[model samples]
Target: MPKHISLISLLVVCSLWNMPQAVHAQALIPHTLQLDAENLERQGLQLAQEAAQLGQFQQFDLALPRARLASQLAPNNDRVWFLLGGLHLQAQDVDAAMAALEKANSLNPENPDIFFALGSANFQQQKYQAAADHYKQGLKLKPDYREGLFDLGNAYYMLGRLPEAIAQYNKSFSQDQKFWPAINNIGLIKYEQGDIESAMKQWRTSVEIDKQAAEPLLALAVAMYNQGDRQQALSMGEAAIRIDQRYANLDFLKENLWGERLLSDTKIFLELPRIQAALQQSDN
Candidate 1:
């Protein structure tokens, strides 16, 4: 799972909300009590930083507990809540992720990243409409956010709004031509609409942009095999599987939003003796 949310700076900035009311009046309160509060907040920030480092290494199991504790100690800090939400999302706990993300949004409603994270959580839960809505809200704040546009495209695709999906994908690609996933997904939509030639073109462009992208490469291979280009299809299929063997599985393809037509063709392609040999070779 991709870590959708990022840890913000740990250097605590004093904001008007948390600033002491009166410098003179603060002398009336015990110095030790203020020091303890400061110490606890500092410790919470340190723990949050540790959790973020673990998350970067994809150690979600270790990260989640620390993030949870950090959120408890730094209850007023939106960044702590955001990190907690991201860890839960990586762990596939959609409900927990949503709850933490909503809390983060409440604390800092102006932060577009929090809304984008909420969109991702909604996406995981299959609430495509809500996901799209959240993505739109985020985009309004930061119009050129590449990932947010791609995610909105996915949400639109899931909702059967192909044109809108393509528009969002194009927007994302415009932001960065090297972003192959958006192009790959556009190929998916084209293939589903029976535009094999256009789909192949998009997939080819994706492969040209990022040769390591197995999804578009496998889709192209499957299409080539269906069109009677056996030799090239087998070679391309082998190369794609070498990059990522998971693409050989139809279930994995489905998870990536491969349409029924493409999946049917890929199923047949996967059963070919040469492809089967490739899969076995890859396992070793």
Candidate 2:
């Protein structure tokens, strides 16, 4: 799963009276122009906050420009760079995001979040080893960071390190019991390894933990179908699609890391008349 860089808690709340003169300046100013670095940073923080707020409203296109302006106005501020990187990442521009985050990391090596951001950027780009390294460094700075632990598990999974992935996923669960994805992903690993019983158990546990999640429901349904429990399998699959119609999509199923055998079974399951009717009804 990709991650978003969170805003820092230390932003100084500046009123209109305290707004820097540069707030009225061009969106992307020339670096050679004389400007107070401190004032620029303060204004940039405000702009970054606005950008983050826009993201909360799902106004990503509106947010990116503000975040870019913040980075330009406060070129030396690590937080602005991080904000810029996060906006890019949210927009799925991995290369740009990684470049901005690398700058943030260089500006403040002590900040664990920078490493976490870099790890997520690399992960999205399918650079699993690089992601693992960055997540490791972030975990070294803050051992209990559950997001880092969970994502490190994802990186390990992509690298075919099943044991290491499960370990990291378990660590994430220990840190935050509400995080059902960790347990759900462990089921995925188990399924990939052909441990069907254990996979079922893990998926059941995940479903109990988060009934609303579509992944475990769909996974459990697939496992059931593979086991010849057609009625139960269809029921679960229907429930999964009722919760989220995207579960019917073959590409989405594959993206969830379904193995060849399981995916083959799923393709057959999808061809079933009842399953096709359920999907069609959901689409309608």
Candidate 3:
């Protein structure tokens, strides 16, 4: 199988393994039975919010059942399903997240955040085409939805439609110039297309926009190294390592640019032969 496909499959399997079972019907019961259902629902929501704020993902997982019960108690409140969907997303239960988010969307179709979450779940699951369609629908509903545009650009990028990716990134950046990921992704696409100068310019702009981000620094270094500017490349590469020692593909850069500095960087050396083969297969 193609490497990326294999990798994705492996990730899916691992995620499935780690996923908690769908909360059983019995699990949705509240501890204290009360006639004042609205008050009980309000208390359940408050607990859910507390769990989310504490970053207690497992607690959030447990809290979702109560939230759903609360929704049952107060069938008219849209916030109950919205919170349930957000909690399911935090739990990485995509199917449940989609269901709850769709329910929330039905209640509040004009809510851009619901579409954004649905788009995000699809994107994470590698349903690129579906993600793009959802993002497009979201943008249609809310023209300045920067998150939708950003994620839509990501879907296009993963599909290897670089021009479309760039257009989406540009649209996202127009809404918020400080959107570092889009800027970094634009640089990445230019680098992949062999436009080293333009790539470096974009990466530099990205770094200017978000000084703490390591991606633009690493990408700029790679672009510089590819263009034979070893000194500047080493400088930027070292800077990136200092910012985020665990930056992805740092070892790949070091290996490719060996006989130069940054050799001691403790990043994973991506096998180029494998990468090239995967790219070739993707093109097919």
Candidate 4:
């Protein structure tokens, strides 16, 4: 795995740096009982930094022990609890993540980031309402949080609240126009609502924004095949898979929120000799 340097580590380092000289000495040395507490806090921050570095590379197994130790060493430190929460969340230990994050939130409820991480954990657990609620709270704290908006949109989408989902996606786009996931998700809603033309337009615009993005390209190619343009569809489909081989599977397509109509159409398209040959050729 690639070595990682996480923002959590930087933030911890900065926090330590910002301390006064006297406290810094106390944090480093074990001269007295009071100083020992400071020393433990400093050690916790170090352990938290190590956990974050490992977590960044998806080594949650290795990261979790360090995060736990950090939290134990500095029970009052919100950042230490937050790191534990993040590690648990990454490892899909939703219950543990929520517990740690709840502690972090109690320590610093004003931090919108804790709510966002809670929302993400809820989302992964398929608790859409909880996710939406957490996202709403986080967004209220920081209205321009683009990822929070997008995630709220996803929660709405999962709840079958299409219009609300689109509204959230549009809000995200307003904040950062180049956010391709919002554009792509809007296409998903449009396609599901039987607006193929609008969906195509969105997908095309999405592809224009990021040529190597496989999501919209696959959607466009499937739409093209459904519209009876074999050669163009085959070429586009080939290009889509070339950009990301994961797009070649039905499960992956469904995960992208391709509606049943499009899924059925794509299944038919993929069975064509031309599409198979072209996709096979591209793999080589």
The lDDT-based order of candidates, best leading, equals: 1, 4, 2, 3
What candidate 3 gets wrong by more than 4 Å, as runs, is: 1-35, 56-76, 249-284
Q: Can you tell me which runs of candidate 4 are displaced by over 4 Å? A: 1-31, 274-284
> Of the candidates shown, which would achieve the greatest lDDT relative to the real structure?
1
- Whose TM-score is greatest here? 1
What would the per-residue lDDT of candidate 4 be over residues 30-138, giving only the tens digit for each residue?
3444565677789889999999999999998889999998898789999899889988988889999999999999999988999999999898888999999999999
Q: Which window of ten consecutive residues has the lowest lDDT sum in model 3?
A: 261-270
Give the better candidate number (1 or 4) by TM-score. 1
What local lDDT does model 1 show for residue 117? 96
The 0-to-1 C-alpha lDDT of every candidate, in the order given, reads 0.90, 0.84, 0.68, 0.85
lDDT, residue 160, model 1 = 98
lDDT of 2 by residue, 121-150 (tens): 998888999999999999999999999999
Which prediction has more favorable lDDT, 1 or 2? 1
Predicted candidate 1, C-alpha RMSD: 8.5
Q: Superposing every Cα of model 4 onto the true structure, what RMSD results?
A: 9.5
Candidate 3 pairs with clashing backbones: none
Report how far residue 260 has shifted in candidate 4, in Å: 2.8
